[model samples]
Target: MVIVGILSIGFVVLAILLVLVRFVFDLRLTAIQQEADHSQLFRRKINHLRKIEQARHIRYLLIICLMIGIGLAILIGSFLVLMDKQQKLTAQNQIDHERIIYLEKQQKQLMANIPLKKYPEEGIGLEEYEWEKWSEEKKDVNLQRQIESAISKRSAQYFDSFDTKVSLSTPKTISLQLKGYTDDDASREMIKSNLDAFAKEAEKVSQLNNIHVRMITSVSKEKQVVYSVNYSRKKSEDKFNKQNVSEQNLKNSGEKG
Candidate 1:
């Protein structure tokens, strides 16, 4: 840019000098023509000489005009380019500002569509936490279906075949029930252990006001309920977290309810 400015200045200076030279040359030629002998042919010759000089100077003036035009063109072109780049920068800044506003307004919208609950093993736990949060703020918004499905799906992995159902009476309390046919007494213990695992895992991830796990089993193929009992909340919730008082207690009350 400095080079361009220097060249433009040089061109303008040269043009001014050329104009001054033409002015002085015209005056000298005019004086010579007047001082010449007043003969017709000689005066005609002087007039002819004057025409040639004028034409030559006009050509030099055109050359000077060309040089001046080139310099002005470069300066104008540079200004236009600078203005274009500034417009582009302004447009980019506007886009960046809009993105910042969107991020600030909707934080939860990020990664909201990922099937975290179905694909990942810990997805249900995440939903449980979300439920604890969203349940208090909005009405008719809960993740109960996913929670129930997760519990039922996990039951087979931990214990013998048992159909599972879960009910959320409120945001803070939930009930789990498992029913299956089993004659071996060991099967009941396995079911209880698995129930404790499920509840504990849930508690680790979410909040619950009351927790109770129930199981029903029968020895015969008729599927009549022979063992039906409800275990109370964890001792951590009631000064006692034991799932059962003992195996003896489970058996003693197993047939009664």
Candidate 2:
């Protein structure tokens, strides 16, 4: 497009130059004829006028051609731009369609695992895990007890107003999500306090456990609010060793497998 535009401008400039040159030549011819005899000068002047008229006609044609070239160039450039945008839109649509299909397949798989095959409108739906199927040799009873104790202590403060949900990820990691709260200093303080309690409990449960937690609070102008807390736990090698020892002791005691 840029190159075409440049060429168009060059042609227009050339046409203008041609017109100027023609005008100068006619003026010079007239000046020369003015020094001659009247009759001869008149004949030469008439011929020069004819030549000037022809040049004027040629200049007009050049101007018209230049205008047409510029118009065509602009039209072609606009078409190319439109075509590029269309191609991008088409590619984006395809990507979105593929994403939707993938999510649909996942949804179907989840539905098939449930006996009822029912879908909920909100919240995550998960397939329950059977603890009995897990290897007893790898079980960490002491760590489990510690986590339960922490949850119990934290829940005692706001169990009536808030529901508690706990999820365990790995041997060391735990994630917590809290919902429903008015956006106020009190709610914020409660969240902070609960988080601090959880952190403290996690620290006491195993010396080598580190906790990472986040809280999200949403409040509306009408005083309605919702909040959630998410936490993860990571256990160090020392804690893992201690857990293994505890498991061995449990196995040696001949406890329930």
The lDDT leader among the candidates is: 1
Worst 10 residues of 2 by lDDT: 241-250
Tens-digit lDDT track for model 2 on 84-103? 99999999999999999787
- Compute each candidate's TM-score over C-alphas: 0.38, 0.33
- Most TM-score-accurate candidate: 1
State the C-alpha lDDT per candidate: 0.59, 0.49
Off by over 4 Å in 1: 1-129, 137-142, 159-161, 222-240, 243-257
Kindly report which residue stretches of model 2 are placed more than 4 angstroms away from their true locations once superposed. 12-43, 46-56, 59-67, 74-78, 81-91, 94-257
What are the per-residue Cα lDDT tens digits for candidate 1 across 1-257?
68877887788889889888989989987897788467888888889988998899879989899988987887887778888998999999999999986763343233222111212234334234355553464534356666656666655434443456767656566666655555566656666655555555555544454555555554453434433333334433442144443222233334432
TM-score of 1: 0.38
- On the 0 to 100 scale, the lDDT of residue 14 in model 2 is 73
lDDT of 2: 0.49
